[model samples]
Target chain A: MSAHAHSEDDHGSEGHDFAHPMSVQTLLAVFFALTFLTVITVAQASFDFGAFEVATVMFIATIKAVLVMAFFMHMIADKPFNAIIFIGSFVFVGLFVIFTLGDSMMTSGSFEPVVEELAPAVAEPMEVKVDGAP
Target chain B: MSTIEASPEVGHDDHGHDHDHDHPAFLAHHFDTPEQQFDSGKLGIWLFLVTEVLFFSGMFCAYAIFRALRPEVFEGCSQFLNTKLGAINTGVLLFSSLTMAWAVRCSQLEQHKGLVGTLAATLSCAMIFLGVKSIEYSHKWGMGLLPAGLFAYDPSNPHPTDHPNYLMYICIPFAIALAGVLLWLVVSAGLGNKMHVAMAMPLTVVCLCFFVGVGLGMVLESGDETAEHIDVHADPNGLASAPVMLEAEKAAAAEAAPAIAASGAMVSVDESVLEILAGDASNTGVTSGLNALEQQNAAAGTSTITGDEAVVGAITTTEIDVMTPTTAGVFFSIYYCMTGIHAIHILAGIGVLVWLLVRAVRLDFNRQYFGPVDYVGLYWHLVDLIWIYLFPLLYLIR
Candidate 1:
């Protein structure tokens, strides 16, 4: 479908007016929701979650971000193609993070001591022994 | 407030695009359909947020690595931080989010005054937030308790002054000064009624003085140490490690001087040492007087000092011991980098909040057009979230 054809406002053969795209109520709802989520995530940080602490916090943050995108941003009513584009972006980020972290974690002990070759006999060096009378 | 405005009806010439053709007043004309426009906006927001996540990820990575390597150091450092301030700031930011939402609501309702009011409220909250944060940061600054790299402490080391963080010594004072000025401006402007102004002036002066005193004292002390550690040793063989060895020897001398003085040996005691020892002796003497009989019995029971008690005394005198520089070095590095980066992000986020405030005051956003407000609000929340972790990780870990 053409981009314009998906517009709900133009499809008024039944004479139904296009509803307000983003109402104040929805915005307020989202605002409170996001604020609450932030608070919860912060509160959760005080507990000793050990290994799950960072992960749990991040999971909640992702949920909050998604909510902001969907409701306050009107993503649900938007064309499906936009979602595809966003998912594509995520794929790239995922690949980048995974590969980089993977490398760091896996090859940690592979760092060999880097040895530099002596300057190609630029000058003769004199060595002195510990005991004096050379 | 700029006069430049884009007509929402442009670039639709191919279909004889006219305003009469079901043109939704809210829809901008770049998209082929409203759905496309909405999707594009959402997609753009996601990408932006992703970049933000990645940007913040760098700080988190630093935090994770340091926390893993020196958990005790992080815990010890965190114990000094005030989590209450962090929690209060979190609440303040959350309140600002509410105001931002209300402002957007006003925009949708076409209530310009309400929009302005809500935005003003949000701005006030942001200002309040920054104010509280300043107080917290300055408290740390004044105490000479900044992270290891900046105001390093080696309570276990005798000559902590000798191992002063030259870099933090140089940088943190200016940052504190700048933050102080900005904070003063915000308070004077945001909360500056006649009454608030009356209350603020003295507070500002006092805070400014406190800030300056701490900064000057730290820099002066650090400068003295740096000067003393200056290497002038002439090595005939030009050994590479000569300066390092020289510095080490100097540190050792600084360390040994105290013990020698304590034992009434050959070392000369500085006024500071005499003062500290005098204080400790008096304090301990008072405590011993309270339990004289027990102390006499203990002294009679064991002629030699107990290992644990000696160790406790040693630990108490760590700031005087220059022996274990490793612990100080390890912990200091972690503390400075984590807290320093966190503070910078807080400053940047505050800047963004200020910009958003200006836009809100201009009545640039309404209920139907509050995307920017929402976006910035999300960013603010993320900043707050990071601090929540940082507070515990740095200040209250133990």
Candidate 2:
């Protein structure tokens, strides 16, 4: 689909538009909420969460992404198809990570490179003995 | 306004209006109605945004896999990043998204003044974001905290002024100057009492000039860094690229006078981006800071400085410790890739918005024909959405 859409009136004033725009107040509210969430995420990162760090940050990020897709991007008031596409795209992203990352973890050890020559030579310092020259 | 609804206005000309003209100048021939056109356009933008999501997802996957494989390295490298700057950038992008949305709403409402105002505001925010990013990049460059092969980070080693990132310094001034020009033009156009075409049109043209100028300038400035970018999977010699050597030259020339640190130039990669680097890791690189720390800590009180003091106070060994990062090269590689792509998108969005601003000043958009503004708004929001995720993942990974 093309990025630009052709309408009856470019600005669509010809017919009273059926679509509804969020009120300025609502838009501002969403803006503030996003900022608040950003603060929360940054603050949370400083504290050690051990294994939960990834999960917690990911969860917060998901919430922020949702708010953006919904209110700021108008997915909430937009066509269902558009919302589905956006959500489906993420689902696919999740799948991509799962297969690649999951498989790599499953068989991580003992997968050494066949060519020993390929390994970059680890530099070792010379041992200087200060006794009478050998 | 808070409880407003999308109910079609009574005056909508869905039925053939009295005007004999079949289509408005803005309407495309194929679209049956305005509603269809609007929905189709929105859907297309959503789809485009979806593609963008998938684009960044690949990078995210790479980062995740590497982090999973080398969790300790990732953690140690994460410390080298300045979280404060990341937070600032997050706020900048979010604010810009808000302004972009406001511009779309203004176009829809036929508020020409607000449309121009919001567009100008969004452009400024983007410039600010880029400026801050450039500063961060320069800081990294100066400290020699680079991606692999070129990774010379030694935070514990004292040598703050070792390698100044000339590229970043050059780009920052260019960005600031152009941003200032754009601001002055927008304000002049807006503040004029009369909407005189002669007066306002030039402002739009000038806005485009600086926007294009800054964009081009940024691309050229980063050209050096981009040229050095290698596919690390190839892992060739772990050779530091030419740009690293060039920067190192300037650094060496600057610091060569301090003969006190000559004894410290014992390691191969110790000097900031330039002087002591002779290509081979063993030729001139500083010994590992971990080793120095052990030796100094072991021999404390014998000299004027201790291990920690020597690391921070002066460059006595070939190994300079700046941003004591371990395995930071891969982490930074991912960091630059993700943020760099996002920054490119912002540049593209800026280009679109600049065009919209020109038309907006032309009074082309009424309530009926603001599709371009709306579409661009969606794109900008998606850019912000990605950053929302990036901030915590890259900066706050703990």
Best by DockQ: 2
Top lDDT prediction, candidate number = 2
Worst 10 residues of 1 chain B by lDDT: B305-314
Candidate 1's iRMSD: 12.6
Off by more than 4 A, model 2: A1-14, A109-134, B1-21, B155-326
For residues B227-296, what per-residue lDDT tens digits would candidate 1 score against the true structure? 2222111123434554454355344443534333233222122223332232212222212222222232
lDDT for every model? 0.45, 0.60
Q: After superposition, how far is residue A21 of candidate 2 from its true place, in Å?
A: 1.5
Clashes found in each candidate (C-alpha, N, C closer than 3 A): 17, 35
Error of 1 at B238 (Å): 53
The residue-by-residue lDDT of candidate 2 on A1-134, one tens digit each, is 32323343354444666455678997898889989988998888656677898999989888888888788788776667788888999899999988888877776631212222211222121221111111
* TM-score for candidate 1: 0.50
